[model samples]
Target: MRNLLLSPFTLPPPSGQTRNCGVTEVLCEACDHLGWKKPTKIQIEAIPVALEGRDVIGLAETGSGKTGAFALPILQSLLASAQRLHSLILTPTRELAFQIAEQFEALGSSIGVKTAVIVGGIDTMSQALVLAKKPHVVIATPGRLIDHLENTKGFNLRALKFLVMDEADRILNMDFESEVDKILKVIPRERRTFLFSATMTKKVQKLQRAALQDPVKCAVSTKYATVDKLQQYYIFIPSKYKDCYLVSILNELAGNSFMVFCGTCNNAQRVALMLRNLGITAIPLHGQMSQNKRLGALNKFKSKSRSVLLATDVASRGLDIPHVDCVINFDIPTHSKDYIHRVGRTARAGRSGKSITFVTQYDVELFQRIEALIGKKLPAFPTQEEEVMMLVERVSEAQRFARIEMKESTEKRKRPKAGEEAADDGEQSSGVRKKVKGGSFRGRSKRGR
Candidate 1:
């Protein structure tokens, strides 16, 4: 038997370098330059498989370094291939496309791999010109890429060898399936494909079947994966008192950057206004906002200058935000998957964070569904005395309003005397009947007739 002897001058590689060191060292070094310190479990597991040139389907909670998992490997492959044109990454949204492109630029600065970003909000001419330089990688939104492919005469993907669908579920949800299928028809059948998503819905599965060739599937967390670093809690409050409870919680928090998720743009705006009125720097992000405004709000939030961002589900998916210490659910999501993505904004990249959902009586069923999906009960946070008092006041106010409405309704049903019309108008002066206005005017007319 022959035994291999170790050389005294040779030393073993550091952590993540041994294949066992995982993504820690690479992330540590990357973060040292980009100022990140940790890699989430998704990144740790998926990166290795991706680097092995295997098609990977990664399922993890959002903000779990899922982007970096596929991105790092793509960057490394590009460098190793040393080809000017080898890979193309397709995302569902312009924001995500730009985000992925930025990450690639940050990680591939030393390697000098030219990368191009193509999205709808920007002009396609510039993108075409960028591609003319023969970039090694192209990150683009599906719709924008299709537009370029059809309109740009010189644009081509003949040299493309790697294709990645980042946030595959969202892409399918956005109705980009046809566009993706068309693009696939253009790309070489032998090219490698990677599909990444937070949750693997049926549509995503179908896409995986069509794109991936004997892919390596990786799930860092369970189906409804919750990060251990996030301290999840729920507060049961009536709908009327949600604002009051949110204000109290904001008052108590130690000024960490937080994101509040709402189900609609109107709700997000309302929450943002209420927070601003309470002296909190809150911004709103939703599809209604123009691309520039959305970018501005994201930039401000990322700058850490703003303490709170109120956003809808559209903003929830594919947003690679950093340093968000907290996530508040102003409205419990109707979709269980959305709830996971909302809270996943925090506890990102292995950072400790807290998520407090303002669950109201009406949201009980929805909250229960979320818990069932996650396979765990969400603990409740005891409302502060002030918050409770605020709730009591709200309940009292609601009762008073209910009583008033009932009284008015009962009075409306009863026949009224001509002279009594003055009373309904809230004026009992000089026996003069001043006709009420709008709805009340009709009631006054009924009495007069």
Candidate 2:
């Protein structure tokens, strides 16, 4: 068995290298169906190594085609010998779990791959029923998977052949160390393991030691690197005038699609409502939302029905939406590393894009840290103070309505009906927006502010 420890390699995969990476004819047809014309650098390096039946530690950032790298090898192996409860893929978030399952199903459709997503924000009994069937692949979050392992009857991973930990750095960052450790103990020690992450944190290093055995390292881009086509800028403004600046920028870049990142769930929701009040087509996706609602919001953004997506950190890493043309950091991230992931939502697939980070007076130190980490000072996004100030009155009204809606939504949750529990978290947000101001406003992003 030859060891492959690839260093940082440039894009545009080597000629005929990706095609010869050991995928069977069936999986090759599936890749062509998905329009995967050329494999990414990570895929070029990691897939062949993974196909060799060795443990793998892949180091790559989001949008680097890491999913295909891991998915194809596992699917190919599954086709060689069909088995139930064969592979277990763990992700840090529910969105990523579903995404991995999608890719697996799409790529393995010819081979009839059945996957189950085990995560929070859905019915446990339903998941238990799915697990009772013993799916071909299990994609899950660490905590929820442990819950089923302990509580759910007739469910276990003893026969699992593959164990994958995607976003291992974030899984540990989310305080899932004990759960991951518990899961590592329960699964078979004889199975193959795959660990992928953007950063090699200390916790990740420890996890690699415990969970993997003599894994090959596939490092693509480890530094704090942003895409060269991404035009990054920052705006220094007063804390109280953030909404005004945001409205001004949206007005300036009216037609371009955007992903606006906020600091918290409530802020994401509030910003969504405020933008809607100002006649912008915006949707919010946060951890506080129900699974269906979160998926609904994501679908809305993906289909281009909504022009702006307001999201928290949960939407930052690993979930790919290819149409976003700009990113706005409405609230600067406390962790400088998050800035990289946030801006990554755009400038994907070699398309030019832009990102604007809002730097309030109180965020100077934090902004400086981001600049230092990225190794460059970003230009200030040009803005007209008079135009921003001119929108203050209207923006203030929108803010007031957002605050009221947030309070009402909170109170509604405190007194949710038995059947309307899911509706408590922004279900009525769309209809509720139309009711504001006698339904005179049009929630469309193409319109100028």
Candidate 3:
């Protein structure tokens, strides 16, 4: 972790501010419209270098305005060149691709910059049509972009001017290395490239060498650290009493929104059902759910229709949902790097937030690894044993119902059919607990089950 304050790529005092970042008049107006008062650290450093027509490797944490660091320069260049499909931004996830497209549209609205989001789990024909029309910016996941490039007719990146790989580490982690290689081979080599990531792993460094030419590294955080405003704590509890502790935390922190992270999709769904049964407005967002349902859960949480969002790592990185008051780690992440990303969901944009991680006996080593990675020890979140016990009866009842619901849901998924909705409802109305195959009432338990 090198000191970024004295990095050679730092912008001069005069142009470090957003108003003097060398963007054109129209873009400045657009920034004003977006209510961006000044440039973030990453933007201040990387934007100036990008505006100078230099390939940039930006290292910044999540919610550090990394998008603006690349977007402003691309938008400025687009204003001058005025070509369709001039820039292409690659992300690791479908949701991130859509979020980047929205930011591009918002920033370039005054200039009428048309953009298209190309990702999986959607209509391909519509994306093909969008590609044919030639949008100003095309934001896509690497795999889907490769699919379109190999299949879509009359579509290519021979004339591309700017290429961006946002969340470059996650892109490689998701096994998009070969797809990225194919994209790099097809796109013009003369284009300017920007690789932005929170951490600089060996893969990212290798990709930077292969994809960028004489890139300037603008790193904002030299070490892994949470935002100053985030109050982080942990709780060590018995595995059996995890649900009770979670219920206590939610009740204690009532009136604020929360994003509770679980390690598995099944556990996320189970916890959501359990919380709902306990009269909490909670929704589940994970990989197993359909794309529409995942987006619905996200929308419900974002619009304040739901106060708690139970999700897996799918919502960990690159999805910016503002107004999240706290992030509860219902299940500690296996990888320490993921901890940074999970807590990052809150304490964004200069707002204060809290993060409470659950550390069972088996998670001591993993929790210590996280503390070492972040270079700090976390204090325990205070909890009263008697109060947690008071909620056990209700939580136990909800747990029973959650198990039944999970069983039925698994059965529904396994035996997919039309017109079975009514029959499923009738079975639920009868409230009979038929013995499901596999084991006792609890089918798949949490980790260590």
Candidate 4:
């Protein structure tokens, strides 16, 4: 059923002043200090309902601060209870899990609420020991949590009262369906569930049915939701020449800091190498990398030591890197869902940002599919003169082949005589001059003379 609780919010210019509202007095004061003035459209509508301890399904964009919408309510709920780890959060990626835990810690720190993050790249024993301390909230990735649940003796979620699935679409994509199912089975049935995503499909709906009881669906944006803070641009180029084009664009831009999205790990690696060879700081982040390396790479990027990040769709979900001015789609994503996730990396937290997509003939279909899914046209940016010139300079001669000139042999050689055809037909005997039997009786001798 459609949730029609509030009048549809037509976004007004965000006032720079913080306002008192649904969140706790401390949270509101924190928002004031942080300049989180008005509740974002999603936060305004979803927070009150969520604070009432109802099951919530928040459909909003990545940068909409949906984290606060759910995090605030969870924090409020925890204030009334002294029990340890009354809430559980399941995130799709380690980076996201870390992000969630960090937010929870920041908000709950004043209240003395303890939180623990469990993900793969870190030591399992450390997580086990932390859980042994009985954290009030456990933030985990589905896989490692299952490993902990199955192996760690005496681990229990029977007392858990709240559960959140952040980026439900991403969790479902990485084949975490079975793991999530197992987690649901172990946790008690009398728990409040919240599922948040940018787009909702049948899979999310089914998961919601299994996990939530009479969920109050709150959709803040449609698939085509446009964030006016973000400026979108597209450039069409060929596949083989994309790397050089990207390098040229990077050099042209003043800020070297960028997050580039590629369709695959191999492509991401290739782009990273090209950028690095040009003395541009670049790193590749993808599913194939070890979690330790992934975390290390993310740290480097966060520290501003690495200016360019080349990544697959894996980087698109749940990871938060602040102060990113631009996001580039180095290759158009085949999946429409990924397109939203990729661009969402920039324009975060109400910061104005830009996203540019590189489209080649091969990516045209993918681009169209995304447009169809999002129900909006991605604005096309005119190719600058420099980009066109770069394209022309990089074009292969073979592909633009033009027949030119040929010259006859330069070295002087004895020409065969018309009547010496018979002599030429026979093989040379033992590499000798053969004298040609008196110069083949006459004509060959005249030519030699």
Instruction: State the local distance difference test value for candidate 1.
Output: 0.71
Ranking by lDDT: 2, 3, 4, 1
User: How high is each candidate's TM-score?
Assistant: 0.78, 0.91, 0.89, 0.80
Among all candidates shown, the one with the greatest TM-score: 2
TM value for model 1:
0.78
List ranges where model 4 is wrong by over 4 Å. Answer: 1-19, 33-35, 384-449
Over 1-449, each residue of candidate 4 has an lDDT whose tens digit, in order, gives 11112222222222332353356676665566555777887887777777667899999988888888888877666654456768899988888888888787776665666789999878889889999988878999999999999998788898898999999988998899999999999999999999998888788989998999887888888764546788888878877777656766776674647999988875675555444433466787877666766777788888998888888887898676777778999888877778777888888877887888899988788888877876777787655656545533323321121111000110111343455321211111112222211212112231121
lDDT of each: 0.71, 0.84, 0.83, 0.72
Order candidates by TM-score, high to low. 2, 3, 4, 1
lDDT at position 354, candidate 1: 94
- Candidate 1 segments whose C-alpha is farther than 4 A from its true place: 1-32, 35-40, 385-449
RMSD of each: 13.8, 6.2, 8.2, 19.2
- How many pairs in model 2 have backbone atoms within 3 A of each other, for residues 3 or more apart or on separate chains, i.e. clashes? 0
What is the lDDT, from 0 to 100, of the residue 283 in candidate 1? Answer: 80
Per-residue lDDT value at 188 in model 2 = 96
Best by lDDT: 2
Residue 171 lDDT in candidate 2: 93
